[model samples]
Target: MADLAMPEIALLGTSADPPTLGHQALLEGLLQHFGQVATWASDNPMKRHGAALDQRCELLKTLVESIADPRLQLAQDLSSPFAIATLERAKQRWPDRRLCFVVGSDLARQIPSWKDAQRLLEQCVLVIVSREGWPLEQADLQILRRIGASPRMLPMSVPGTASSQVRRRQTTEQLPKCLLPLVLKHNLYGFNTTNP
Candidate 1:
């Protein structure tokens, strides 16, 4: 069990194929709600990624750097496809602080089915950030609680800019300006130097 008296650190892991403005907004919002926020880019294991893990990490690092907040850290060491494994690693790194695993509302329904879901819930508080299109349902929250999770809703709205749209349309409008040069240099997500 985490120490409630300790400061809470938000752990956010995502498949940042090409980090978008939405990701930046989410990170900023998390910083407002928590004392510290640790974010990383990792393979989701369930979905296919356009860029390699290292490339995604670079993009995420750029996004974190752009935020220019000391409280927001790009902790790639905690990157893991399994949330339980990430939480365990985080516990080792910050044993004195309470860990709050951050996930978007789109992923809320899949929590109960995750590996070692019960144990993961027991170790950290689950903080769900509401995405623009994906609404958080009461039934999903109930299911998470039934499976031993104490979930809290983050009172912030995430921009609707999704990486999928960027990849499918091969557009750079959704991407952060800092990532544009990297994306063009690497030719990631089928985007080339021709794109502005």
Candidate 2:
């Protein structure tokens, strides 16, 4: 019963346009670090991704289901422009859990400019997934530290795979294992199931 009361949660929010190997590694790593992993498919106002909001959310749900890891769970897209808003909602839902927000190094650097950035940083633990090509420099790391964000790093050799690259080259390139089926069936990322 003690386990039920322990607060351990981590949020891995992304567009997850189709999800990828990088996303998988990050989620798996988060699963190990926390009692529950909330994978959110958010729609960023800044960019138009491969899929729409609901489509991306559905893809996330599908990918999570395929992995079948009990530790990994899906969170609502919330359609909130601000990460702070989503964090607030996440806090309300998991009132008993210690919330941690996971971001890649690039996003980590951009956090300072996000809406209510400081509040978002203060709301929960910041977990940074330092990917292969985009290593976090000490200077940037210091910047985050200066902002009162002592982020924990989830180190892994995730290749420099971007969702944009996938969408652009979907016609000729190979799809990630987990996303292939959904991409094929739903014609996502402009993937042509016939040749794939």
Candidate 3:
């Protein structure tokens, strides 16, 4: 058999309110293919009041504790104003590794609108996992190609869950078990959700 090669991959996610089992599943997948998996939480400008930066960072730490792999380290803040610049910094930090940016199909579809989308493509290879009901349009695909993103789809089913849905029903009796700890730690439900 030919030797197995480990791809250098980095996973980025938002523990915006809290991370659910689906997020854990994604990270597990990343650890399988990459030699090193660095995870970063997003400080999305659009999300007005999910969790503060420090709290979100703390929740990420809590969620990562369950993972057994040492390769998964906390990625520095990538939620800066210039996403492409942040990606460039990440490339420099991991000079010995082949950097790959991992995201869900929901976010993948909106790649064209991202800040400096072309520069982001030039800095890192994008690996987008499938999310159910998130239609991948030809226009977006063309845009990704134009930006030099070698997009590859992961063979996995999308978990029909989202932070929005979770926040909407915060008062429900039972919360998602996997994300309960994170939710409680960050006081996720305490935030005002007038805007996502």
Which one is best on lDDT? 1
lDDT of 3 by residue, 38-65 (tens): 8766667556556677766766666676
Q: What are the lDDT figures for the candidates, one per model?
A: 0.92, 0.75, 0.66
How much RMSD separates candidate 1 from the native structure?
0.8
Which residue runs does candidate 2 get wrong by more than 4 Å?
A: 1-6, 77-79, 171-174
| Worst-scoring 10-residue span by lDDT in model 3 | 1-10
lDDT per residue (tens digit) for residues 137-175 in model 2:
888778788877877887555566777777877642434
Cα misplacement distance, residue 47 of candidate 1 (Å): 0.3
Q: What TM-score does each of the candidates earn?
A: 0.98, 0.88, 0.81
Candidate 3: the clashing residue pairs are: none
Between candidates 1 and 3, which one is better according to lDDT? 1
For model 1, residues 18-124, the per-residue Cα lDDT tens digits are 78888989999999999999999999978999999999999999999999999999999998999999998999999999999999999999989899999999999
lDDT of 2 at 31: 73
Model 2, C-alpha of 194: deviation from truth (Å)? 3.6
